[model samples]
Target: MTDRTPGEPTGLDIALQWAELPPEHLKAALQALEPELARRHEMRMLQARLEAQGAEDRRSHLLYLSGLVGGFLIVVAMLTASVIVGINGLPWLSAMLAGPSVLSLAGLFVLRRVDSGTARQVARAHDAALGAAQPTPGAGVV
Candidate 1:
């Protein structure tokens, strides 16, 4: 290996630096970056999405608890909407049947009211759910 200092370029390395590269060179550069960038971007997006999905029960993330409470309200709303729509027909009836959309939507709103840390917890919980899940039949177990 060639010993070099910082900010000092060797002849071969200097030749590789594309100060005057054509537009086509950009394609190669992008091609080299494509997979790595895609992976990095995907990971970042997943991180944000996870953060948005944290739990409300965490101590510092009590705001997420609002969503949990509102979830109960949403269920109530859907049941109420369904019962009302059962007497009616058309879109209203459809609304009753589809009221869970409202319930889940409300859940999302409640989730949104939470802090970023809690949202991250939600994502972690969700990810954990997707892993080798087993019944943890205890008072406080994963």
Candidate 2:
């Protein structure tokens, strides 16, 4: 005869539930899930690193574009300023515009360096994860 209690899990259910016990108890209770968990962790780390690389690339592209825009604006402004300088004679204003345009080029160079560094970090994480993979080619790492 079997008496049933509401909200009480079966023995199999209990065993399955025990599978999620934290790392310390995990070795004793359920070793099966460890490989799955490791794979999940690897995937998550890979995704995060890849996203960081992508963001860095986009930032670099934007900086380069901004620099190009600054250069183009300087050209147009210089043309107009030259006409004004010839007629009204204010050469200093044209020189001021040139300064900001040159400064933008420097800023773009710095941003590209930052972007490359961030991309390198992402690559390094990927390499680390790959190295971790070689040690546990089997299902059970332990």
Candidate 3:
């Protein structure tokens, strides 16, 4: 590596400092920096795209988690109410309240499975869109 100090002027910095240079030489200097400028622009665009995608993923995950927690809380509340009713000598009403809790539990399980399946499908589609070859799930080493 060259013995460049931290305060060393780079090519662009040097180009900018030559404010009194002839027009043709200034044009040549700016043209020399064109490729680097284009690369930096493309990098910024790609980083912006990735940041947007990450934000969307975080928002979607938060919504899914909140819905799951809300469902669980509802189930817990129903069970608690059922137990309280049973303790108060209302066996028939307690059973009725408990019935919905069982159904809610089953619904939550199905929803979770469906959500996971959807996530897998989305990932597969993303890979496909990017021209990546994803191996079959169980077709790898034993």
TM-score of each: 0.29, 0.44, 0.53
Residue-level lDDT of model 3, residues 10-124, one tens digit each, is 7668787665788888888788778866886788888889999999999988878887777777777888998998799776666656653345453564365445565565555
Best by TM-score: 3
Error of 1 at 24 (Å): 74
Q: Residue pairs in steric clash, candidate 2?
A: none
Candidate 3: how many backbone clashes? 0
Going through the candidates in the order shown, the clash numbers are 10, 0, 0
Name model 2 segments beyond 4 Å from true. 1-29, 88-142
lDDT of 2 at 133: 35
Model 3: residues with Cα > 4 Å off, grouped in runs: 1-12, 101-142
Tens digits of lDDT, candidate 2, 11-93: 46756777678666745554665565577678888888999999999998897888667756656665666567646654454
Sorted on TM-score, highest at the top, how do the candidates line up?
A: 3, 2, 1
lDDT for each of the candidates? 0.58, 0.58, 0.68
In model 1, pairs of residues that clash are: 51-119, 51-120, 53-122, 53-123, 54-118, 54-119, 54-121, 54-122, 55-122, 56-64
